[model samples]
Target: MTQALVDGTVIRGHGVASGHASDSPYPAGTIAMQQPYFAALGLDLTGLYLATINLDIQPAQWRLLQADYTFRALRWTDLHPPEDFSFIHCQLLWQAQRYAGYIYYPHPATKIQHFQSPRMLELVLPWIATISYGARARLIYRAEQIQIEPAALL
Candidate 1:
């Protein structure tokens, strides 16, 4: 009975800075900074998955979203975030469950670096165990309509 937003294949991501965010000094503060927004939005953190799922998307689909989706800036530094490092807030849906999270793209100052793609969508949910590498998942976004196909094997 679950509705799919956009179906995509889970693929290996560029491992430039593997598992660094969780180990950084910023995570606790970052979580603290984000807590109020989550509360204000009525999102439950207990059910969130700390890990991210990298979805392989098509260029046309990416372009379509660029034309339609309105991204909100989430600045996490003390006082105000530097222009370089910031995150965007968005909603992700999987298996009919809606998770409030952000799309994190590394700036030059960011602790994690990504070179494979221009942008990466990071979702924090509770059921990350349900999906695996090469598994196809439906990425549901509330903002705009999008279509994602399973990544072609290299």
Candidate 2:
């Protein structure tokens, strides 16, 4: 399998992931609460941050045809019904640093809130002190696992 690289820009996202959303109903953050459940299911997210960094790979949108891991009807929160999630291995390159992470995808068909745009590819990475909104980054992924195609003309 060939790994392809695409450049993207870091963008701000709904604060629900980091639990920093002032008006968010889930103050503790979605990931923080779901961590334990995912861990118990075998994905130990020990060193990874509890938040996801939204990356805009615009002019290109992603399709989740296949996932390295998928959890169906995960009962991680009581606020809403269980939602499905999928993740794929993602490699990031930023400022001469290479990061190993995952492309976090919450199945929209089952998701009830915090909807994300198709142009944005949410990533779960380790705590990176230098990363900030508006930074440029590149992601390496397998085409078969995560299909990226040109955005439809509007």
Which lDDT values do the candidates have, in the order given?
Answer: 0.46, 0.89
Give the worst 10-residue stretch by lDDT in candidate 2: 145-154
Off by over 4 Å in 1: 1-4, 15-46, 59-102, 105-112, 116-120, 144-154
lDDT tens readout by residue for model 2, 10-79: 9999999899999888898888888888888877778889999999999889888788888999998777
- Best model number under TM-score: 2
Candidate 1, residues 23-125: lDDT per residue as tens digits?
A: 4444444444554564554544565544456765544133123212122444545544432323344555555666565544334343332443522344444
Backbone atom clashes (below 3 Å) for every candidate: 4, 0
Model 2 / residue 104 / CA error / Å: 0.7
